[model samples]
Structures are given as C-alpha cells and as structure tokens.
Target: MIEPTHYLSSTVKGLKPSGIRKFFDLAASMEGVISLGVGEPDFVTPWNVREASILSLEQGYTSYTANAGLLELRKEISYYLQEKTNVSYSPSEELLVTVGASQALDLALRAIVNPGDEVIVIEPSFVSYSSLISLAGGVPVSVQTSGEMEFKLQPSDLEKAITDKTKAVILCSPNNPTGTLLNKEDLEKIAAIIEKYDLLVISDEIYAELTYDDVYTSFVSIDGMVERTILVSGFSKGFAMTGWRLGYVAAQPEFLSAMLKIHQYTMMCAPSMAQYAAIEAIKNGKEDVLHMKKSYRQRRNLFVNALTEMGLTCHVPGGAFYAFPSIKETNLSSEEFAEKLLMEERVAVVPGSVFGESGEGYIRCSYASSLEQLQESLRRMQRFVQKQKAGV
Candidate 1:
C-alpha cells in the first residue's frame, strides 16, 4: 500500500497540529458549544475596506501585482508606520508584502537561519514561533515568562538563553494567549540584550492596534533598533481581515532583500485586490479600528472579572482580546481542565500547555466574540468550575 507518511519531510512529520485548532474542531462536532478558543475576531471586515476590494475587482484590477506588492500600498504602509510609531522605512527597499504576518515571520526566519543557528523564543506565545523556527533549520530555545510578571519576557531570561550559535529572537507584543503588551521600558532592556548579543529580532505586532494600554510601541521605532529588527504586522486582528491574506515585513535593506528573495520565489506576491484594499485601510480605517478596540476592551473587562469572580485568578490583559486565567487551584493539567470543561459544560477554550510547557496550569479564553456569547461562555464555565469544586 502507498503511504503518505513515508514521503513526508522529517520536519513535517515532527510538527504537531496547532493546539488552538484541536479545541475548535472538537467544539464543531458537539451541539451548542460556546467556543472561546480561537483568537480570531468575530467582527466582519469593515464595509469601507470590503468596498475598496470590491471596487478593485469591478475596475479589473485582478492581475498579479508587483512581487513586492503594489507600490501605492507600500507607500501607505510606510506613512502609516511613520505616523503611528515614528519609524521611517523606505518603501522601495525595506518593505515586502506577504500572505500574512505568519508568512512574514517565516520569511524572516528563512532568510537568516543557517542550520543549527539558535533562535530564542519567548514561551507561552503563539504556537507557530517554535515550529516555524525549527522548520527554518534553526534551533528553538524557549525562555519562559510568568503570569506574575504579566507574562512579559524578562531580559535576564533572554540573556541566559543566548549562546555562540544564537542568531535571532522572536517577540510578540499584545501577545496571543497571554495578551501582555511589552511596554517601552521593558523593551529598552531587551534592546540592550539584543545589542549585546548582536542578535536580529523578528517583532510580531499584529495585535498592536488592539492595545488598551498607553500606546503601542514598535521595535523599529527604538533608537538603533531598526537596523536589527524585522517588523511583522498584518490586517487580520486589527481590521477583521483574517481572510484577506495580507501582511508585511519592514527591515533594513540587508535583511529585507534576503526575505524578499524567499517571498519572491515562494509566494510571488500577496493577493492583488487585498493590496489595493489595504491601501484604503491604511488611509481611512482608523475609526473602524478604534471602534473594534473599544468593544474588545469592554469584553476583556467582562471576561476577566467573570473568571476572577468564579475563583480562577486571571490577569487583566493589557492588549489583544484574550483572558488567560490560572486553573492551578483545580489541580488539573491545562488539557484536563479544558477537555473536562468542554465535555461537561459545552464550552470550548484552548489549553495553555499548547502554547508551551510553562502554560500547563492555565487556559486561554478569547474575548473576541460578541459580549452576549462571552457572557454565556462565562456562565457555563462558572457552572463547570462549581461542579469541579463540589467533585460532582
């Protein structure tokens, strides 16, 4: 018999499926499941953005765009970054459009990682960072963060993780699963370490616009940091444009050119209409982004309060739309807690262990759904917790 597994690359065979998707799949099979697992926004793409894409199609702008993406879109992205973060990037030489922030990260890794080069990854982060690093022929060294520190990556830990072979570090602000935004002071400390080690940085800022903190800071905006940082961002989380398949990377030409080579050979370019619509988004979509951010803030408060009141200690998320609550009181592994909660109460959430070993005693619940849905999921979770306490 022919076997597909035999033909798989070692990397593909070793890679595990995303932990978030496992709960989502289980919830789909069950009736009446209230899911808070995925980090995706439930909001539709704002009308103006959609209209722009539609208009592009109507105008026969369906041809493949330049390999780096539309010049106009790149220009807008440059302006947007400068306006928001005070960072200046040359659109022609320092930016490359990608399928999504995921691809941007992949391109960054592919461009820099030689076999056996080590990349430091902050733990309990988005699941793909380690896997992608491994797939890029780099070794992934995890540095765990803690809820006590609001899951912010510590510079001491980062310094300890580096070795002679270390090449880069991956950072996610307004982090997924944890929702901790790295503030300027902490980032300055990290910048010092990166400078000391001469390591490149892949900064994922997809959730920057959703921050409820003081202001979103860009790694590239930091003095002297732009030369060594590859900034990855997308329209997904902020614009509710997950399906648009649009993202970009900004770096000095040295790194950007290398990443562009991989992108040119692999993806060719991002979708044409999406590139056009993204130009519109950058120019006129601030109001919609703010509106969604306000809604997410309310949901974050509601979800965090509900979790704490139910006896699960939860840190208030500074940004992004997730509430990561400690389930250590139940003495259940994260997977055990999440599975039992879903089986008993028909509520779905991601087990923390999926993100990394440090997440074993917690669970990640996204508040990106409607307030009504979040409330219902909380009620079910509360009842489930009560049952666990009663040992029923």
Candidate 2:
C-alpha cells in the first residue's frame, strides 16, 4: 500500500491562517456577539454602482472578461491613480485587475519572490503579507514598529533590516490593525532606501481613499519611486464593495507582464459584472468613500478618546478603521486579553499577536461596525477594565 503523507506545499506550510478569522468563527457560534474583528465597511454598495452592474447583466455582458480584466476597468484605474495619486500607468501594458487585494498580494509575491528571497514586512500589520510571501517562496523579515512612534516604521528601522538577500519591502499605509500612516518625509526616506538598494517596493494602498487629514498619496508619487513601486489597491475598503471582489495592480510594464502571468493562469479574471460596476465606482462612486471616511473618522475619534479616557493607551490612527490598543495594563497576553473581552463583555476583537510576535501586547478592534455598536463596545470595555483594576 502506498502511503500519501500530508505533503503540504513548503511554500504554504509556514503560513498562518488569517488572524481575523478565528474570532469571526467564534462569533459565528456564539449568540449576541458584537464583532469588531473584520475590517470591512458596514455600508452597502452605492446604488449607482449597482445599477451599472445591473445594466451590464441586462445587456448580456456576462462572460469571461479578458484575463487581465476589462479594458474599461483598467483604464478607469489608470485614470483614478493619475487624478488622485499622481501615479500613471498604461492600462494596456501595465495593469491587471485581480479578485480583490488578497489575490493581487498573492500574485505580486509569487511573481517576484524567488526561493530564499526576503520580503521586508513591517510588523503589527495585516496578516496576509508574510503568509502570501511565504507561499510565494519568499522569506519574511519583520521589522517591529513602536506605539511610541504611533507605530510608524521609521527610516532607520528599515535601513537596519535590509540585507543582500532582501528583494523587496512591502508597505501598508494608513495601515491595518494600527492605522498609522507614513507622511511625505517618511515615504521619501523609504523611497531613498529602495532606490539605493535597488529593491522592489509593493505599496498596499487599499486604505488610500479612507485617509482622514489629507488626501492619500501613492508612494509612487515620491521622487524615484514610480518606476520601482508596484501599487496594489482595491475597491473593498474604499467602495464598500468587499463582497464584489475587485482589485488591481499598477506597476512598470515589465513587472506587470510577469504578474499577469500568475493572475491569468491562477484566476482567469475578476468577476465580470464587478469590473463593469467598478468603472462606475471609479467614475462616480467616490462620494461613497468620502461618506464612509467621515463616518469612520468619527468612530475612530470616539473610540480612541473613549479608550484613552478609560486609561488604555490607543495610538491615534490617521487612516484605516482600526484602533490597536495596548493590553499591557490588563496583565494578560493579547490572546488572553481578547478571550476575556469576549467572555466578559460579549464584544469580539482580534489579538494583535495573531499578526506577528511584535503584536503580542495589543488587540485590533475594527471600527467598521457602527457608532452605536462602537459606543456600546467601549462601554463594555470600560467596565471590563474597571473589573480588572478592582480584581488587582
């Protein structure tokens, strides 16, 4: 008898499942669990955007779009980048629409990471970067960021981490979990490092449109970065179209050519109607992003202020819809902190340790739910903290 061992792909075995999923599963089983775990908008797809998809279906536009995606969608992305971020790309030669930023992440890493290559990941980040890099046969080197610096990844931190084996540095701005952003000077410093090391840069700008203080700028907007950076962005966070499954990559034509090979072979094209709807989303649905951003900022301010008032240290996030508060005062590990919060408060949040070792003393709470929900969660959290203090 031949034995079939559980020979998982070496590329995938090191990857951890998403940190956002476990609590979500637990929430699924429990009754009356208020989840602040997942990072998706509570808003519905804009009606006008939906109408375009509805029209596309009515007009029999249901079929396999070009493997790279629809010309119109790519072109819209190209235009949006130029108008919004000052980054330009030729849709014909240098763009690929993917099935959300997740696939784009997978395709980008797989396309460039040779075995043993290193991809620098700033820690306390979204979980997918390292995992996808691992599955692409790349080693992940994590650089820890401090809450004292508002979780900003500094220039010296980046410089200290680079080595001969380093192939690329992945960046998530208005970052997940912490919501920290790289200002222009911060971005320029990283760009200079990339220029010096001749390393690839992949900028995850999925949260670009949700910026609070100023308009979001692509790292490619920095001098000398446009040619080396691969900009990965999508409609999920900005357009409230997470379920629609659409994202895109804009990079130098040579790299785009290579990435499309993986995308064309693995996922033929993004959803057909989604491509059409996204065109409307790019052209007219920007208002939806503005509305959502305004709401998220309010929730962020309320939660941040409330948590700080409750004696928990929360870094004021500039963008993204999460607040990563330190759990050190609770005298519990991050996982223990989260479990206790769920059991004691009926509020669900993810442990930061699930992101990486650097996240051990924090928990990520997404404010993407609602004002009322956020207020109630904060109330329960304050009560829980008081109980802990009293118990101490």
Candidate 3:
C-alpha cells in the first residue's frame, strides 16, 4: 500500500514546527512550571470590549459580514490609524479586517510574493515571518542583527541583503522576543534604502501601543513609504484581546484589492461579533490600553533588571513583553540552556536559536505573567544561573 505521508505537500513536509510552541507544550504537560515562553498578554479582555461583543450577539448580529469586514469596523480602524500616524486610508478601498494581525501578515505575503522571489526577514524576528513567506512560495532571506547593536536593522545591512530577486522586507517594531522599537531616525535611514531598491515592506505593528520610552512610528508615516507599506496590526497585544482573533491591514488600494481577493476566498470575513468588539476597541479602548501598557512597562522594568542582576546580559526592551538575554556564559547552546532551566528550575523560556542563526546564544523570556509570577521566576532563574556558573 502507498504511504499516506507520501501524499503530503512537499512544502508542508519540509516545514519545522514552531520553536516557541515546543517549549510551551512541554511546560503545559508539566506541573509547577513557570512559563515565560509564550508572548501572550496576561490581562483579561477589557470589560467594555467584551460587553460590546455580548451586545452584538444579543442584537442577533451573528451573520457573516462583508468579505473585507464591516464598513463600520474598517472606518474605526481608519480613524484610529489617522489619529496615531496622521495617515489617511479609505475604509472601503484601502483597509481589510483579518482574523488576526498574523492573518493580515499572511495575506500581505501571499498577495505579493511570487514563487522563488526572495523576501528579506531581519533575524531575531517573530517566528511566523519566515514560515509565512515560505508558505507564500517565497524564499526567506535572513539578515542578521546582533544584541550588540540592540538588534536594530542597520540601513547598510539591509542594502547588502537586496538582490535582483528581492521582493520585499518584513519589519516588526517593538519587536517580538527582543522588544526592540525602531526609532524614527532608524526608520528614515532604512526607508532610504527601501526607496533605493524600490522594495515593498510589510510592517507588523501589533505592539504599537505597548511602547514605553519612545513614540511608536508607523512605517507608512515615513515619507515616500505609505504607498509601499502594508501595515498589519490588531487588538491582540495592546488591547489584551488575543482570543478575539481580530486584526487589520492598511495599504494602497491596489495591494488591498489583491489581499481582499485571497481573504474573500479563504476567510470570507472576520467573526461578526469580533468585528463589532474591535469597532468598540478602536473607538473607545484607549484608557484600557493605557492601563495595560502601564502594567507591561512595570513588568518589563522588573524583569529586565532581574535578568541583568542574575548575570545574564539582556537588552532593555522598549516595547512588547519579552526579554532576550544571552546565555553564552553558561557554555550551553540556547536549547540546552532552556531545557536545563526547565528541568532544574521549572522555568520555561524559548531558546533563541529557533528564531534565527543570529539568535543562537540567547533565550526569550516573556514578562507577560503576573508580577508575583515574574518575581518567582526570576528567583528561580537566579538560582539556576548561579549553579551553572559554579559548574554544578
């Protein structure tokens, strides 16, 4: 008999499983584990957002929305973006509501990437970026960024990565795992290189509102970039609405139209109740977002300092809730360090090697847990580090 595995798509067979989820699954199966592995917000979805969804359901608004999503939600998204970035988009023509910012990203990739096209993905990036590119039939080219440089993608480095087959770049600010926020100056320099290459950019800004020290700059707001940028964001990170599964994409109509075609056929529309809730979220969720941001900032401060105090060198994250600390001093690979820490201390973190080759010596610890949990995890980590240093 023919093997069933032989019928699987070559692309699916070749793909590796998520590195973050591997540790999360192991921690999930074990008791007494302090998981700093997953990057989800610990906060409950704000009351008002939940109420809005409940109201929508009570109103019997359970039917599928338009393929692009409800016009009202898209309008709210447009207004929110305009208020934040001063960039205007026509809700009907230039916006699309997706299942999540992740879906928006996938749609953008699928819309633009042709088979064999090369897309530049900066290292230490969100794990899904490369995988989504491959699923879109594009080649993912890694451009390494180091902790020494605070993991910022330098313009010079970006220029070196581009070739004739290069199609676009995937940029995430207030980045996942590292929490590095690209400054306006950094963006301007990078924007110049993008213009020189005439390349497109898919900017993932899911953590836009979680920025602590500096203002979050939208890539579309960069001069000459609005037309070339596909802005992907959602309520997941900032609004504590990951379970809601709502996100959006804003781009030129030409690009939006293409993505909409795929979205229409595949997703049809975002959940109707979720769209209603997202409308409420973008319209009146500011105070709740501010509260969450304040809490995440406190956690970040406590967590990064604790990591440093434990003798691990960690770059202070400007946004998002993760702390990537080098584990090189322990003389263990990233995976080995994480495994030993999990087994010995019952602390779970994602190994940096899974992110990219450049991420090899670090481990990503999310501080999205409660303050009490973070404190206890740090104590356990400190003990583990001391033991490792003593060669015990």
Give the clash count for each candidate: 0, 0, 0
Reference-based lDDT, each prediction: 0.91, 0.89, 0.94
Q: Which residue pairs collide, candidate 1? A: none
Tens-digit lDDT track of model 1 for 262-376? 9889988999999988988889999999999999998888889989999999888889898899998887899999999999889999999999988889999988998889889
> How do the candidates rank by lDDT, highest first?
3, 1, 2
lDDT of 2 by residue, 1-392 (tens): 75444666655555667768988898878887889999889999999999999999999999999999999888888898889877678999988999999888888898899999999999887888888888788899999988888888888989999999999999999898789978888898888889998999999999998889855667999998888888898999999999999999988988889999888778888999999999999999867788888899988889999999998899889898989999888788999889998987899999999887878989999999878898899999999988887774
Per-residue C-alpha lDDT of model 3 across residues 1-392, encoded as one tens digit per residue: 99999999999888999999999999999999999998899999988889999999999999999999999989988889999999999999999999999999999999999999999999998999999999999999999999999999988889999999999999999898789999999999999999999999999999999999998898988999999899999989999999999999999999999999999999899999999998888889899889888998999899888888889999899999889999999999999999999999999999999999999999999999999999999999999999999999
Give candidate 1 misplaced runs (Cα > 4 Å). none
Q: Which candidate is the best by TM-score?
A: 3
For each candidate, give its TM-score against the true structure.
0.98, 0.97, 0.99
Sliding window of 10 residues with minimal summed lDDT for model 3:
277-286
Superposed Cα deviation of residue 271, candidate 1 (Å): 0.7
Q: Rank the candidates by TM-score, best first.
A: 3, 1, 2
RMSD per prediction, one decimal? 0.9, 1.3, 0.7
Candidate 2 TM-score to native:
0.97
Distance (Å) between predicted and true CA of 19, model 3?
A: 0.6
